[model samples]
Target: MKGRTIVLDHIDDREAAALMVDGKLEDFLIVGDAPAPGTIYRARADRPVKGQGGMFLTTPDGPAFLRQVKGLSPGALMLVQVSGYAEPGKALPVTDRVLFKSRFAIVTPDAPGLNISRSIRDEDERDRLLEIAHECMDGSSYGLILRSSCAGEDAGEIAEDINAMLAHADQVINDPETEPELLLEGDGPHVLAWRDWTDPAEVVTQAGGFDTHGVLDALDVARGVSEPLPGGGHLYIQPTRALIAVDVNTGADTSLAAGTKANFACAKALARALRVRGLGGQITVDLAPMPKKDRRGFESALRAALKADPIETTMAGWTPLGHFELQRKRARIPLSEVLK
Candidate 1:
C-alpha cells in the first residue's frame, strides 16, 4: 500500500492486469474474445462504402473497415493492422499504416525516419539512443523511433529491442503470401502491463494477485453505475446505445461552492472511470448547476485531467443544454461486455 504496484493475474479464465497506485486501481486491462489492437493481417479488400470514402475488408479475425482508402480495388491484397476495437455489431477498425511497437522501440513502416522521443531531453542520452538505432536499423528503409522508456536503460538492451522489432516488421511486411491470414497476433494484457506501466512498482505475477491486492474489489466498484468522486460528489456512468451519459450529484455537500466543487470533481473522475471500464465513443457529462461563467474553468480542468490518458480524446465543447461532450477513441472492448 505504499508507492506503485502492478498485479498480473487471470480473472474468470481471462488474462487481466491491474495498475495500482498507492493501493488504488489506476488502470486496468483484460483480454476479450475480439482481437486486440495492433494485430497484423494480410487481408483482401471487399467493397467500398459509397460517400464514406472507406472500404470493407475480410480479415482472418473477421470483417474489418479501413478509412480513407484509395486506389484499392475489390479483392486487392494488402497488409493491415488493427487500429482499435469495434463497436457492437460493427466491423473491426483497421488501418493500412502498420506499426510494430515495443517497450523501447517502435518500427514504423509507413514513415521513414530515425527519431528519438522528445521526452529524452538529455543530449547525451539522445545521441546514445540514436547511435543504437543506427546500428540496429543499419540501412533499412523502415523508420525507427526510440521510445522515451529507453532513457537510462542499457544501450545493449535498447539495441536488442530495436533489432527485435525490426525483425518482426520485416517478417510481417515481406511474408510473400497472397492469401488472407493473421500475420501477427496482438500483445495480450500481461505483456501490455509490462510494456506501458513503466513507472517503478512492485510486481506481482503469481495467480490470484488480484484478490490479494484488492483489484477484484476495485473492479466490482468499477462495474457499478455510480462512481465516487472527491469532495463528497459522485457521478453515474451509463452506456446507452448512442453515447455514455454521466450525471453529477453533489451528495449533501451544502457549501457556497458546492456546484463548482461537484463539477470539478466530476471532471477529474470521469476520464478515469471511462478508462477503468473501457468505455469510449461519445461522452456527455451533465455537470452540477454551476454558473455559466465557470464553463471555461471546468473545460480547463477536464483537459488537464485528460492529458495523462493514453487514449485519443477530443473535447467537443459545451452543448446547447449545458452538457459537456467529448469524442473518445474506441481502443478497447467495453468491460461489461468482456466480463459477461
Candidate 2:
C-alpha cells in the first residue's frame, strides 16, 4: 500500500478549501481562514451554563464547549483537543480525551490502555499485536491503538512509533504553562489523509494554487454530479436535509448480464461517492430490478465495497420498496453545509 500523492489548494470559494488525494478530491474543508481540526489547546474552564449541561472553555482560538464535563470545574486548567471548527454562533467542540495519530498507531493521553482495530479479524494476528502493544507501551500512562496499517509491519518499527508518540505526549503534558492557548496545531486534512489512508512511503505533491487545472477538475468531480459508470450505466446521488438518496440507472438495456454488471459498477461508485463527499446519516440506494436469485449476490457486492470506507458504516437491509438502506457515523459537518 504505497502512499498516495496529497495535493493541497485554496479553493476559489472563500468559505472552503480542498484536499486532493491521488489527483482526486478527497475532502472539502471550511477553513474560513482559521485553524482546522486536530489542533490542541490549553484552556481554562469558564462558568458552566447550568441548563446546557456543558461548560464553556476559554482558549486562544476562542470559546469552546466541553460537552461531557465529568471531572472538570470552573476555572480548571486542562488540555483540550479541538474536534472541529466552531459553527456560526456556536462554540468549538473540544474534548479532554486527546488522540495523537501516527501512520500505524494512535496515542491517547487521557485514556491509558491498549486496543486494536476491529478490522484485523485474525485471532492469531490480534494476539500478536496485543503482545506488541503491551511490550511497547509498558510503564507508559497513555493508551495505544494499533491501526490497520500495522497488519504486516515489523514489530520493531511499531515499537519505535509508539515510543515517539509517548515521548511527544509526555512533552505536552509536562509543560506547566497555565495560560489558555494553543499547545500544538493539528495537521491539515491533506496530511491527515496521507497518514490515515496512504502508505508512509507514498510521495505527496501539492498544487501551487487553488485555480490550477488539476484542482478545478477534482472539484468538479466532487460537486456531487451524476457519475457515469462502466457499461453505459450511471449513479445519481442526491443529498438532502434528511438523508442521501442514490439512483442506479442501468440505462436502456436489452440483456440481463449488462444490467447486473451495471449494478455492480454503480455500487462501487456509490460507496466511493459517499465516502469522498463525507455524506453520512441515513442513505438509500435504489437499484435496478433484478431476479430474486441475483439479489443476494448484489447485496454482498455492495456490502463488500462499503467495508473499505474509513468511517463506521452499516447496511440496514432492504426496505419494503426494495431500496438498500445504509447508516454511516457522522464524523463532521457534511460537504453541503461546508460548501455553503
Candidate 3:
C-alpha cells in the first residue's frame, strides 16, 4: 500500500501488468486484439491516398496506414513498424522510422550517432557510458541511444544489452523479403513491464497478483465514469465518438476558492485516470466555473500534471468558451474497448 508495487498478472489468460502507487493504480497495460505497437513488418506499398499524403500498406494482420510517406511506388517493399493502436474499423497506424528499443539501449537505423540520455547529468557517468558505447558500437553505422536506466547500472550488463540489441537490429535489417511479412512481434505486457518499469520496486510475479495487490479493486474503481477528487469534489470522464469529455463538479463546498480547488484536483485526477485507462485522443475539459484571474493558475497546474505523464500530449489552449483542450497520442487502446 506504499511506494511502487508492480503486479504481473493475467486477465482472461492474456498478459497484463499494473503499477500501484500508494495503493492506487497509477498505470496499467494489457494485451489487446490489435497488433501491438513496435511490431515490425516488411510491407509492400499499396495505392496512395491522393489528399492525405499517406498510403495503405498490406500487412499480415490487416491494412496498415503510413503517413508522410512519399517516393514509394506500388509493389515496392519497405520495412515499417506499428506506431500505436488504431481506432475500430480503421487501418493500423504505422511509421517508417523504425527503432529497436530495449531496456538499456535503443538502436536507430538510418540515424548515425551515439548518444546518452540527458537525464543522466553526471559527467563522469556520461563519460563511462560513452566509452562503453564506443567499445560496443565500433564500426557500426547505425545510431545508439543509451537509456537513462544505464545510469549507475552494471557496466558489463549495459554493454551486453547494447550488443544484443545491435545484433538483433542487424538480423532484422538484412532480411531480403519483397512481400508483406511479419518480421518481429511486439513485446507483451510482461516484457514491457520489465523494460519500462526499471525503477526499484516490489515485483509480484505470482499468479493472482492483481487481486492480492489490490489492482483489481482499483481497476474496478477506474472502470466507472465518476472519479473522486480531493475535498469532496468529483470528475466524470466519458468518451464520446468525437472526443473525451471531463466534467468537474464542486460539491456542497460553496465557500470561496472551491472552484479553483476542484479545478486543480481535476487536473491530477483526470491525468491519472486517463493514463491508467489508456485513454487518448482529443480531450475537452468542462472546468468548474472560477474567476478569470484564477484561470492562469488552473492552466499552470494542468500543464504541470501533464508534464509528469509519459505519453505525448499537447495542450491546445483554452477555447473561447473557457473549455480546455488537449490532444493525446493513441499510444494504447482504450481499456473499455479492450476489456469488452
> How many clashing pairs per prediction, in order?
0, 1, 0
Give the residue spans of candidate 3 off by over 4 A. Answer: none
Candidate 2 matches the true fold with a TM-score of 0.69
lDDT, candidate 1, at 153: 95
Flag clash pairs in model 3.
none
Off by over 4 Å in 2: 1-35, 41-96, 115-138, 151-160, 172-181, 200-216, 254-263, 290-296, 317-321, 332-340
- Worst lDDT run of 10 residues, candidate 3, spans 331-340
Number of the top lDDT candidate: 1
Q: Residue 97 in model 3: shift from native, Å?
A: 0.5
Give the better candidate number (1 or 3) by TM-score: 1
After the best TM-score superposition of candidate 2, give how far the Cα of residue 91 lies from its true spot, in angstroms. 5.4
lDDT of 2: 0.73
Query: What TM-score number comes out for model 1?
Result: 0.98
Q: By descending TM-score, how would the candidates be arranged?
A: 1, 3, 2
State each model's CA lDDT, in order.
0.91, 0.73, 0.90
Predicted candidate 3 versus true structure: per-residue lDDT over 1-340, tens digit per residue: 6899999999888899998888888889999999999999999888899999999999999999999887989888889999998888999999999899999999998798999999999999999999999999999999999999999999999999998889888988998766789998898999998889888989999999999999988888778888889999998899988999999999888988898899989877777889887889999999998998988888888889988887888999899999999999888778897675
